[model samples]
Target: MPATSHPTRAAVAWRWVALVLALSQLAAPAVTSALAGDFLASGATNRALITPAGYAFGLWGVITVLSAVTAVVIVRYGLGSWWETGILIDICIVFVGFSLWLVIAAQSWLWVSVVVFGVMVGALAHVMRKLIRHRDDLTCPSWAATLATVTFGLYLGWSSIAWFANVAAAFLDEGWSAEGWWWQFVVLVLASVSAIGVTLMLRGTLGYVAGVLWALVAIAVGAAQRGSPVLVSTAAVAAVVVAVVAAVTWQRLGRRARISPATA
Candidate 1:
């Protein structure tokens, strides 16, 4: 029943570095938004924060908050441990990569930015899995990890959709018309399926709910663009699929809880 020792100076210094990096990234959007006056607005040539759908693109806040929490947790628990090292590495790589992607995207390297963002998302997923396995070692608030996992997963899923949207938008802007309406239908089906898969993989009903909200927000933005009915319809379908999946998942989890003992 002895008290644990505090983290070493090195660990504390690393956490401070993480905090600084995270805050810098989080503040970038506000700086750009103020100085450039919608330069990063949706469809703008310098758009880095806003997507084609005009969502505020606040994933940076989520990323920053998570990174800060993770850093604090590592500092308090001593990153000398294997689990702490692994988690710290994951957080650093993913967050730094994501911040770099924002810069690339802002420079109009859309395709390169998309790939980098995808890698960041994959890294986040890996980090979440590792955290879940070592959940007991995490000393932060439960809500911290829960929010981090859910936000990271949903953001990844949504960004995947946005990546395709960016490609499609670029193509359209370049005068490449779709061969037929069928392609739009295909996009809709794929988006819906991807959302459902991501939701299920996260195993959180709130994650699915977040996905649905994101889908709807995307659709609303698409509608605002005076886009084709086909595209709008696709977004609508994706939202519906997310909602239904979330409901089913909630019911299944509820049933399992009911059949089990409260303390078991």
Candidate 2:
């Protein structure tokens, strides 16, 4: 019998679905840009303190590259197990939803952007939970597991912070008073706490933590550019605190992974 005949109909169907989703990862950026107009300009129109530096948005390029890498990984190895397939589905939702978000934002539907972000982040969170729970799955080789986890982890981490920023921008668009510096401080504090909480929950996945740290540092830089000394200091402190927790969590996860090698 041919090797292709071994998989059942469902397995074959899944392979095709996985391949399409992986390709979508590569296509998302171009489609998003075409439909959404200039994301940075849109962001600037309703900018808030939580907003990171314009350059910080460049992380999307890193993500796109990682997505390309993930696409190649999936094609080369195939979906090794249901766990991987599920993660792929959730990630596709994120990419598609994010494109939708930019389109909506372009129309100045600020509240709608918030809701869209909420949905996208929820999908990302689902992927994170699955990755954390199945970290040691023997069905997936080390390289596949690492690549998937890191890719999704980065997505979730950035989306987590982006969600808060979306909400703030929405509020600002409504002419909600951000008159005082204190409100921005409060939001920054809340974001930091939330990032740290998620990091601890995920056992310090390096990719996710790196995403969070990247956004936080970028937020500080943006604040500096805006000449808000107080905001800059607060964001910097938050980044440092999250970094410490992430370092510890990453170490712990590594130790656990080594001990449990094949014991997902």
Top model number, TM-score: 2
Instruction: Residues 1-264, candidate 1: write the lDDT tens digits.
Output: 123345555556666665566656666666655644553454432121112354535554664665566555545444333355555555566667766765665665666765776676677667656554455665555666565556555556555666555555445445545433455456556656766776676554464357445755565465546545665666666677777777887788788988887658
What TM-score would every model get versus the actual structure? 0.72, 0.84
lDDT of each: 0.57, 0.74
Candidate 1 ranges with C-alpha deviation above 4 Å? 1-14, 30-52, 55-82, 131-139, 169-175, 178-185, 205-208, 262-264
Task: Name the regions of candidate 2 deviating beyond 4 angstroms.
Answer: 1-15, 18-36, 42-46, 253-264
Scored by lDDT, the top model is: 2
Q: What's model 2's TM-score?
A: 0.84
In the range 1-264, model 2's lDDT, one tens digit per residue, is 112223335544555565565556566667766876677565633367667888877787787678667766655665455465666666667776766776777777878888988887788888788767765542545777788789878978887888787777777776765544677778778888999888888877878988998888998887777678898998899888888998887787778889897786
lDDT (Cα) of model 2 = 0.74
Report how far residue 126 has shifted in candidate 1, in Å.
1.7
